[model samples]
Target: MKGKNALEMCARAEYGEMRGKNAFEMCAEAGYGEMKGKNALEMCAGAGYGEMKGKNAFEMCAGAGYGGMRGKNAFEMCARAE
Candidate 1:
């Protein structure tokens, strides 16, 4: 999906006041784990999925190794330094 659509869906997941199965499924379907940049981290973190959080962290590391800070820097730094 496009960055905008992913971001909008994430925003909807965050503040649309939707909850339970629908919200969880929507967040899962938004492909938040596959998103890039800060938006990806925010959405993944906010989604409250343990697997998604781990995936996001891994993506962040890969992005860092690729030499692009984007959203990975913070995650990688925190994970490693901890």
Candidate 2:
């Protein structure tokens, strides 16, 4: 049981990392990669928008599915292909 929980946590961390990396790549493609201060790529790559004190780019892209849903991560939204 302890191993299962550990694996689950590891999987969640990996998932978040993948999501952040993908978000950064997508932002780069869309020309939102760079900025004068903190770049969008960094923002997406590291903590994402949620950790920046609000919702992440992926969650915002989710539209209606994430409407009014507070305290939920981007993983809850089915906007991106998994």
Candidate 3:
């Protein structure tokens, strides 16, 4: 997705007010943001997934590197990472 789509997802994922999602879930779906998880964070950051969302550190790394999580390009790349 484009930067605008990432920004929109970030707006919808505001802390504590997420619509049907937790931080990890929202961050993963937004395609950018920071969460916790060393392996995942590094990979996501390297891929520039969260950069568009203004995330200082990449979040949802675990999701992007694993299955059972949602992200666009990152999700597709999970296969190789895993």
Candidate 4:
């Protein structure tokens, strides 16, 4: 677990170094969940999620489902939680 965490930290550091401003900006807009293990509730509170339109929200929901954010109420709950 420690090794895995170290690897993840290294990956995050490399990602930040490579992506620079764009990555940080996107992370700030979308929420740390995109980069870390943030909960669905926290993600829902982010500005990017709030700024999404109907179609975009639907697409995001679909993606989230495939990405392990299961449950019918998850998206709505997250959004409302925000």
Q: Candidate 1 residues 3-48, lDDT tens each?
A: 2233343344443433222323444545445542234345545544
For candidate 4, the lDDT comes to: 0.35
Q: Write the per-residue lDDT of candidate 4 for residues 1-82, one digit (tens) a residue.
A: 1222222322344354333333234333433445343333343343254333222323545445433334323334233321
TM-scores across all candidates?
Answer: 0.20, 0.28, 0.23, 0.20
Provide the lDDT at 58 for model 1.
44
How does model 4 score by TM-score? Answer: 0.20
Give the Cα-based TM-score of candidate 3 against the true structure: 0.23
Candidate 4 wrongly placed segments (more than 4 Å): 1-35, 50-82
lDDT of 2 by residue, 1-82 (tens): 1223222332333443333334334334343334223433344444334434343444443432334534334444322223
In model 2, where is the ten-residue run with the lowest total lDDT? 1-10
lDDT (Cα, tens digit) per residue for candidate 3, span 1-82: 1233333444444465445553345545543334333233343454445433323333443344345434534333332332
The runs of at least 3 residues in candidate 1 whose Cα sits more than 4 Å from the true structure, single-residue gaps closed, are: 1-4, 8-48, 57-82
Report RMSD (Å) for each prediction in the order shown: 11.7, 9.7, 10.9, 11.1
Better of 1 and 2 by lDDT: 1
Give candidate 2 regions above 4 Å deviation: 1-24, 33-41, 45-66, 78-82
